[model samples]
Target chain A: MNTQVLSGKPLAALIQQRAQDEARVLENSGRHPVLAVVVATDDESTLWYVRSIERAAERLGIGCRIVDLGSEATEQVLASVLRDLSAEPSVNGIILQTPLPVGVKADSLVGLIAPEKDIDGANPLSLGRLAVGQHAFAPATAQAVVELLDHFDVPVAGRNVTVVGRSAVVGKPLALLLLERDATVTICHSKSGPLERHTQPADVVVVAAGRTGLLKGSHLSPETVVVDVGTNVLPDGSLVGDVDEASVTGVAAGLTPVPGGVGSVTTALLLLHTVEAARQQEPAQLAAAASAARI
Target chain B: MNTQVLSGKPLAALIQQRAQDEARVLENSGRHPVLAVVVATDDESTLWYVRSIERAAERLGIGCRIVDLGSEATEQVLASVLRDLSAEPSVNGIILQTPLPVGVKADSLVGLIAPEKDIDGANPLSLGRLAVGQHAFAPATAQAVVELLDHFDVPVAGRNVTVVGRSAVVGKPLALLLLERDATVTICHSKSGPLERHTQPADVVVVAAGRTGLLKGSHLSPETVVVDVGTNVLPDGSLVGDVDEASVTGVAAGLTPVPGGVGSVTTALLLLHTVEAARQQEPAQLAAAASAARI
Candidate 1:
């Protein structure tokens, strides 16, 4: 590949090391970083993700609990379960997996999570805090993007950064995070006229527009660090990204690979948040979940 | 001026016209946009601002009322007042002016205002809504930025826009608004490193950072539109903007003047929200308020 692949492994490892250090500090202080993840059903993907969290917590010496509510969980049951987790002294971070069965709206549950406990930063309150530059749980994936950029020694300060997409989950927060880093950021979405025109001038091009291969090299600067967050399954059962791999590699200087880039770092980032939440809540919570798990 | 200016005069007229159209529909439906502005011992400037709101409401055919509280207002007293206003049907929007006594926290009072009447969009919940792309009130000054941009036929879509500042009242919400309009938005604040570098590449630069002459000709592209939201008074008793006039008029394609730009549009937007809140509230509440006023 002509384009240098921006490896996330080392950056994710750095984040993991910090989490481990935090976990140790918590343990020394008789406080532990605790994360409670709720999965409503036995989807294969959810199982894998939950396992990743569980193992990461083990490796970092942090507390991670998996709560399975089953497929038929109602919103009331889910909220009640979340409330219990929120109130538990041992639980510092909470992660609710998506695809919460049919008829259960994810939007309604977003507001239900306490902003502090929202490790994934999906709560509207957390999001609002993010917008206002207040004390907030930075959305993990978006935070990871910045972390990865920093790890690569890419200077966001005074860079022209263009972000494609405005989904609350990734694009919007990512753009804000970049802005906070002093990069002049422009966010493009479906409504943005002439997407390529915006993309080509940026020093950093981050495509989280959801559509597979929506961005090509034609839209990028020569040495732009391209971060692609799209994970689309091609007809051939292959994973594709928002940036057309063939085109970007030849034209761009550095690019993040689809599967091993942002996606791989997500679970690790969650682990980091779990540890952060543990450290924050250690004074007030953590032991309660320990006892609850025992029961 | 070489720098671009987003003059608010044209934009204010446009937004007011829209607000007027909504007012007619609301009144025809037996609903009137009613605003309840409460203040504790208003300072001169504060009094002037209130008067401006009254005039704007009167001009728009929107109903307006005031709760001029004494300086010795307590949190309990204000909370009780807000609670009554929230319960009152006629009060569509609730605006609490400042000079808040030292002990009183402005944030604490937000919970007391009903979401429907939170026209100032000061409530954290409402601000959070804007962050998450949910339907909520955008702060007056921030919304005015977009309204002004749109009125001037600014091609916000796919443009690189930078907002300098992150104050809840202006910078933060303005960034969100730009993102909504499909602009690639980057936000730079005090902590933002090498912040001026980002401004040079921006198609549109919005300087809400209050420090006079914070933005200048060297920090901008000759084609950039400079919207200065700063309202500062100079030693010579002259109004000033964040951008140094000597530097900006020679660089930016367009720019907003300090006195006549963003500061002018904010009140009109507040009135618009009040009218909207009035239209949304039940008629029984306003009639009750009308009765109370008569007594």
Candidate 2:
């Protein structure tokens, strides 16, 4: 098998180095880049994800604040919290946790975010920005999808890339990013007819839909490279990807494991964007103000 | 050789009915939907397009004012004109001509139009609103492309739809609109490699590269329904679509022509959007206020 794993380790390392460089620049200024991570209705998965972000932020020398809310938090309550954070002078970025129990709409929660503080890009403003070629806090997971591929020296420009799924968080944004890089991208979803027809010829396949074995070997040719973005729980309570690992290992040229694939690179990307967001907030100016106050 | 023409004449007829119905609604409310057509250069194509819009508006009893500036109009001058139109009670919609002179940026021009007043869907705010599934004036051309496919009973839902092009006016916005329809959309552009690899299997293909005959019959399978958005002028002054009309006609099941396809549907769409924009504005409220003052 000519299969190669598309790893995010290298990109994470590069981003870490850049973060340290930026930290020094921020330290020279009086202020640091702060990301306020709001966690409401704490699920096990959310806890694990939050812990990782906390560790990553510490290692990167960036400020991280975890805001907790009750599971019964109303949309207004959550929105008010976000609005307060947005108004806070010290807070440079905001990341709101999703799946805020029953009755709360993700749509309404999204509009509450100040476009400038929305580092997670849950807001439509950010999505629209990317659509029009403006600078936006692209969904970290989506950015990681491409960053991982680029780190593996996978040539995306002019390649036939088929991305599965079209959520704002991944498939949709990734398509735009791929178009920006000049890749011919085709997006397929659960509704797409004859999935094999779209997958068989793909130079690169990114499967993000949370369905197990969605892309089997029969759907891919031996030359196809697969990046599975799904982190689905199997019947046995184990993690699985959208692409069937068994079929791809023997038939496809390359495959990324479900957990180690997109999931591994995602947290680091969140931190990377956070640090970049901080740096963009003018660390030098903050440092000067602090130094002046000290005198 | 089974290409059936996706005739816009029938589609235009259908849309004209909708436009006239909307016009009746506005006329009864004692408010005519008004569109302020702002033009700087008297480019032949621009003049022709403006005339078409004027004719459509006149037929619908919608008011249109041609804001003509000299060919050498500066960005500042044009922006100021748009700003005034945005504030004016009479102007319910605004259409800014593209290919702005040397000094004016299209992005800047779009920035000036109020989201409600932006009938052309040229503004960043409008584009952002569209991405998140909000009601915005989507670019008429992009909307027409999708509307044609949907109107023809071409099922976009769950189709492996590949769009080649990512221009702000056509490609990018169209991708977002298709995604909204639950179709798995992939966007390929000039940078996309082996473009045929993406096109060959697409259930639906939309080519809007602004280059003539970019998608050939050999590039697509017989089942692919092609919507050509290109309006390139041939060396001999003939207008052609991105797809070769003769080559794919027998092979592809459905194809749209260059001049008669998207172009014909576009002016009617521009008028439709203007009427919609006018309805959204409170022209009724204005007239009522004036009448109350007179009483």
The CA lDDT at B249 in model 2 is 81
lDDT of 2 at B225: 92
lDDT of each: 0.79, 0.79
Best by DockQ: 2
The per-model DockQ list reads 0.39, 0.58
How do the residues A43-113 of candidate 2 rate in per-residue lDDT, one tens digit apiece?
A: 87777778788878887778889988867888888888877776665777788877686898777677667
lDDT of 2 at A118: 74
Docking class of 1: acceptable
